[model samples]
Target: MDAAARDAQGGLEWRVTVPEGATVKVEHEHGAVARAWAWLLACMVMVRSTVAGFAKRVWKIAVDDPRKAVHGLKVGLALALVSVVFYTRPLYDGVGGAAAIWAIMTVVVVFEYTVGGSVYKCFNRAVATASAGVLALGVHWVASKTGELEPVILSGSLFLLAAAATFSRFIPTVKARFDYGVTIFILTYSLVAVSGYRVDELAALAQQRLSTIAIGIFICLAVCVLICPVWAGQELHLLTTRNMEKLAAAVEGCVEDYFAEEPARPAQVKSDGYKCVLNSKASEDAQANLARWEPAHGQFGFRHPYSHYAKIGAAMRGCAYCVEALNSCVGAEVQAPEHVKRLLCDVCTRVGTQCARVLREASSSVATMVSSKTLDFAVADMNTAVHELQGEMRTLPSMLTVKLAETTSLMDTMPLFTVASLLVEISARIDGVIDAADALATLANFKQVDNDDDDKKRETEMKVHPLNESDTDDEASPENQITKV
Candidate 1:
């Protein structure tokens, strides 16, 4: 059987079915004119959607971040300038339309939001374009001398160059900054070489290409620097500070709620806490990489503290790990005795306060480029909080033994002491964060205060911080330590 279906738009599609040992006869036909019109209509629909999408995005950007509007304006002005220069009387006649397009493309390609980024791209494109032009000229000269062999030589050369350019993207350093340049290099080289074969004036074509590329690079750099420039470094600084604040909030929320009497939390709050931590890690890492291309401006010198920023990010992840463990222990699977709970609450309070202070101070320092010596005081407070928590932790085993002794069924009560052991592990991770923060402060060039010798003994206390309660529980089950207690 043969069947045809008509779409809502009156387009028809045919289907045919055949049984075993039977031949199915079907007709599938559309006039060339009708098919062409249908394709045109489809193209029109796609064009409409594309324009609508572009307009919607532009409106969204204008509303969300007005500073980005300057980028659009800059691009429009540069494009206008390119059109004027290339379409004008003397220049248009001098450099033909074919040659002018590469110059215009350079304007669209090289311009970037940051002055440093634009400048870097400008120089890279210029070098790649000029080298490609020269190499293309040499290849054209070789092919011309070969006469009938020209096609073979040119085709082989293009194949080799294209393969090489494609493979170059896999190189780590090239993939980072120059991958786009390599692609553009292959394109420019092919265009020049192929066009040179057809055009009588190859030298003039090469000269015009190099000149046009230079014009584009110069104009993009000038506009990026002279206009309302958005420095990548400044953006990175703000993002890093904001990420710190977000991390601080998440940590505080997790720690505070975990130690609360009612451990039950709204699902949204828990989800948001972990989401913020995870999102900040991804955002901070990307921004750090982009910031590497930024030049020194304002407070930063030629060499910025990218390494310190990375270390801070790593420390934040460590803090998030501890928070996750705390969250895991928050349920009825773990419980703290009244006295130990109070001590844990006190530690959480101190840790929260010091963390907030450190975040504020760090953010302020990043913004103002003024080193805060008070971070030394904050770190010291965190260290003390960690030490006091460790002291409480030392007493936990004995207290748990006593508590276990009172219970008739040790197996039923074992989960409660897991909270105590988890608290010890959390304290050690917190101490690590404090140490990392101190190191980060040093890297930030903060004025160092005299180290308090008293904390040196407290550092040794951290060694006992990891109390693997699982092993303890297992050993207790086998040896009947609960019975001994």
Candidate 2:
């Protein structure tokens, strides 16, 4: 009986231990499988998110400027045209397979967004390739006659020419206009010089390369100019005009913000307008450089005053700097008394308004390519306001000295004074902008504004908003009437 009970208990214990072990093993396997599935899901989600983000960015880029898409299409078209050389047996036989590759390479390197940029690159590539080929052939001939000294002559000539071309890039004019050409000169010369040592048919090789490259350049130029051509000169002109408008908005915003009854929120100030002007030097220089390469197009002549755009940009930037300073003053912690601000408010508003008017007129002149006869009147009005501002400034010291003697420190008044001074400086800089615009008009032969048309426009405006008796009296005022030249 005792032995039977012990065996029964042992069996039960064995059964319990085996099943428990098996359950634990099963659970472990299930956990691992779940974990593997979770990891895969996470990876799939990440990949999906990444792809969505990439697509969003690409869409944004395409939408923001459809020109980019057009440019891409143009490039694709050029590549396809050049690829025809490879597919055609007769053409391939003429240039050979290796030379045909040069055409494809030329399209890739020489195609640019603007017609000016494309022309610049194409001309540079063609000239550099031809010049290098001719010179390399000459060197090859000379080296061939030198017998054992052939290698030495070729190496020395390559070294000197490459060094000279590289050094020429440091020149300001060369660096600005012909830097790409110089770079191509170095590349072509080096390749030809080095290859000539091993290649027996050097002349034929050079000729094939030149012809193939010319074919590529012609295709690129034709595509760039003939299909939705973007002229750098027109772009530069528009950019200058837009910048002037931005500057005007900034000037007006700055003045209004400074004199507001309540201090302006940071978001209320239109700083981006002026900030753009500050950052546009690089774009201006690049566009101007490219514009020089563009031929006559639209209203622009072959010798259109693209350089004057630079001068206008410079003048606009000078005003922007002053506006920046005024902005700082407006946002300063030191506050001037309300009454003190009121003292200068009328004259300051006049000055700011007149300054902005002058900028707008100048901008309009550039945009329309029409010389404004009334621009002189606007400048004179701005000057008169500036004089009024100076008079107001002259009176501020005594008024502040008396009124603020017991109430506030002199440091508190400095912000207002600084703002006033900046406005004056900005007005002076605006004169520079006017002069630059005038210079552009003269050089570009901008159409003169017709006095009769102006008179008719004014008459139409008066008829639309007929002047009251008081308005007529104001217009008759000696201070209000401006002599039109």
Candidate 3:
């Protein structure tokens, strides 16, 4: 019946006919919503203050070896699921619910895309914060439509919203964008049909629900600001950074060992380089865990601040190993100086190919990150430089080919100095690129957030009401201050 009313012109006419002194707080969210904002701030501070370690770990991992860190998303996501389950009390309390969240997040994600962000690309906060706003609006709309509260409608709406969110998981990240406003619209319908709340009371309701809304924001922000940085710094200085130094030492040692009077074979060098790459990858993972996942203080979140810094330190090591592997491939001739072998050539080709691929992926991640941001000044310079380095990665094959040909000119001469020199150069270049990108990203972290505390998770109205865009757009812009309840 409510759906029919939404379809028909007069269905919701009564909502607009407010009494002389009825409450409406939309036009002035800040006027009465400041109290709710404080609560939200408190919640955010408390949660972030608590989860310092988790955020640190996530940052560490992202920097150390983003490729490996990406692979571990399943574990991160699983833990997130567990956390979500533990927080279900908010749902029964009528403060929050899952489907409502999904609808909101979906709308935010889509809105970001419309405004030039690529969904699921680089700007994680935009997606996350936007989602929060979406959920708030969706829930509020539903409450307005219904004349009385009906858990069933909200519940069903939640189920549908969840389905939509789940579907979003499978979207081709590089393809067309999706907006989940449809789900929010549906939730709004559910709430309005049974929420005993009149359409006109939405502003007041948003104000009334301030406590719940503030709490959630506080939770997310606290995790980011209070905990992860310090521990993450140490983790990088120790594990990842230390491990990289060792990998460098090992590369040099292995090359010398393979060549000493004993006449080592290409196989030994190849195997050793492979081992270093694998270890480098693992270290990157562990470091990211410490940096990106760990919250600053609390043990509740998945981030491990220390781990993220360690990952960056470790990735730097991996860059070193790539150089070593390339060296070992080229150096096998001089070290073994004995056995008739074409084996080292094969090793060089393989190592170079693999290292090139890694750099390519690394470059792509940066580009994607750039595309996701509304403001690029924070990272533009770094992005441009690293982009060039990433490009240099592809140039490795040419350099190697020229060196190999030069070695061949000797007609049985092993390219010892030539390979070593090239390996070192490649390693240095790649590492330099990764380092610059990491540092720039670190600086941008502080700038990611806009100053406004109340992030309006506005819904993308698929079907616009008679209300003009001006009438409906009340969310915060970066320039304006918002006090959402």
**Which numbered prediction scores highest in TM-score against the true structure?**
2
lDDT of the candidates, in the order given: 0.64, 0.83, 0.42
Estimate the TM-score for candidate 3.
0.31
Model 2 scores a TM of 0.86
User: Residue-wise lDDT of candidate 1 within 1-485, one digit each (tens)?
Assistant: 22333654356465456566655432223356678899999999999999999999989989998878888899888888888766687876666656777678889988877665686677678878888878877888889888899878888888899899889999987876786679778988888756734435877777877877877777777777778888776776676666567655665665566567765565536324535655566666555655676676766667677656666666666766766665665555446554445644665555554555566566666666555544555455455555665676577566557765564343433443454445455445545545655565566565433556435423433333232323231222212333333
* Segments of candidate 1 deviating more than 4 angstroms: 1-64, 196-200, 262-264, 267-274, 280-286, 328-343, 400-485
326 Cα displacement, candidate 1 (Å):
3.0
lDDT tens readout by residue for model 3, 397-473: 45546655555433343344355345445545555645654563564342244434222321212112122112211
Best by lDDT: 2
Q: Global lDDT for candidate 3? A: 0.42
Model 2: runs farther than 4 Å from truth? 1-39, 196-200, 401-411, 453-485
C-alpha RMSD for every candidate: 14.1, 5.7, 32.7
Which is the winner by TM-score between candidate 2 and candidate 3? 2
Please identify which of the two predictions, 1 or 3, would achieve the higher TM-score against the true structure.
1
**Count of clashing residue pairs in every prediction:** 0, 0, 91
